[model samples]
Target: MTQALRFRLATPQDAVAIIACVRAVRGEHYPIRLLYAPEELAQAIAYARLVFALALLPSTGEVAGLAALEPSPYGRTGEMGVMMVLPTHRRRHVADDLRLLLVAWARQHGRRGLWGEVLAPVADSPDAACVSQRFTENAQLVPSGIALGLWPGPGGERQSFVRYARPLPAKASSKACRLPTRHRALVSEILGRLNCPVSFTADSPASGAGILDAKHEEGLRSWVLAVPRIGSDSAAELAGAIRRIQTHPDVAYAHLELPLAQPGASALCELAEARGFFFSTVTAEPFHDGPGLRLQWLAQPIEPNGLLLLNPLARRIAGHQSREQERVRPWAVAAAA
Candidate 1:
């Protein structure tokens, strides 16, 4: 059954075929707006900015499966998202082939880790997104955390994502992470699963200049404020940024990423949590210079109880995050109102 297809890295010529395969599998709800743009997508593929391993039906040269390998800004990690196979190709090893091909390409390109976000189900079909979870688990990737309400729909409705992770040999970092004991326990559990070495610091270092970068998602009306270095003024800078961002009535939310392995990350993190940001997840990949401790501040409130997670680990995360969300729920509600 698997021998019926040919798998290889995609080129600009595969732009039409990839788009068609995505449409055949998901129609217009594919959510990746890049698929709708032919020229830019082709350019992205040509430049290697958007790399894909494609499964093609040699008889007709039609794309049967698609898997992407998106490298992060830090270049230490590659995101493995949506090894999608058309419905007609189900029960075959088409997805497995595409997944393996993408993994091989990532290794050849020096990607140390493949810890990425798996988009949670949308409001319409909450369980439909589990296909990726099945694949992630099959690849021996451990499910660590959930970025609750991370993805946004065209109608302003937001969805969540599971943190799927599998770190390669080169990705193991022996860095010491500083955090409160409460967060430290879960993070420790997750890190143990990834086999990443870690030691805990007794206290968060005080006083440095906040070194960070802020990027916005115009389409999703969200922001990712990444703090690589925590300075004495980081909390202030973040507060000012949050105030400015929230002033935009249509802006959905803001995500703050702190370098967990860095010394004052927890101190700055504590301050952010006080300012209405709540736990999202400890990112599987390295962000800034190390693993990111991510927190989110939403302009709207989402019912955490409503999450429909089938996997045991996912359900466990839902429970943990439900409590985390509760701590900051009042602040989010007041801001939204």
Candidate 2:
């Protein structure tokens, strides 16, 4: 017989069951290695501060299936992880039920949207993708984007991750552009001089951030220029800037550099969440790159991986929520069907 599924906030006591579930579902549909280690089990529990776990009961309280709701960086956003249904629980729609429970919780808790990434298993079995595909379909999560990365195997196997989203029936508003009061002219100069392109910084209360090397900071930092990269690429520049921000004593919170793709944006957004920055708003469209070149706002954070829905879908959800809440009460629930 199919077991009844239930959901609740996970407690420390649930660690044993949770770990067992992880083992059962291991190596199937996730980049589990990046997020967990044998010693990091405690860290996982700690990291899941904003989590809700789903389980199926054989009778009174035995877990037969399980999934977790862990925190995401971009303010109220959160991620669904380690969704596992034991072999016996297969075909029961427990995954769908758990996802719904997680979504409902996010809607109520002021989260803007939900993001999920699915990985294929190492085995030749099609069951992994089969089950994940069904779950995404039932949840109405559109395959809006993909992330490809090389993994160990023949032909340098490329793992595929699909993106899914669900907006609350209630208002899920995002942040608006706040014009900066300082550093406009200086930033304009740098942009004009470098022929810089892209809205690379978040909306600043003062002048928006800038892209300055050490020389730039040494000379014309009279205003608040939200610098892009002190070095070449996004990662190195961000890391360098973060160190500078830490030592400068004059600088405030740090800035960001986001990749434009759904998966990249989501990954960077998760990093932002771990760091405790609130996502503000997302600036997109053809951004100015140089004198004659431009690039899409792939990923640019106001504050380094700070709170902001740089993702288009997520941004929309946040904006919609905020607008609806503005019209009425933010927390008023819609009637159930």
Q: State which candidate has the highest TM-score.
A: 1
Encode model 1's per-residue lDDT on 22-126: one tens digit a residue.
888878765467886789789989987778999888889999889888776653677777567888887887767787887788878777667777766743574
Question: Which 10-residue span in candidate 2 carries the lowest summed lDDT?
Answer: 291-300
**lDDT top scorer:** 1
Model 1 worst lDDT window (10 residues):
283-292
Model 1, CA-based lDDT: 0.74
**Candidate 1's TM-score:** 0.81
Error of 1 at 275 (Å): 2.7
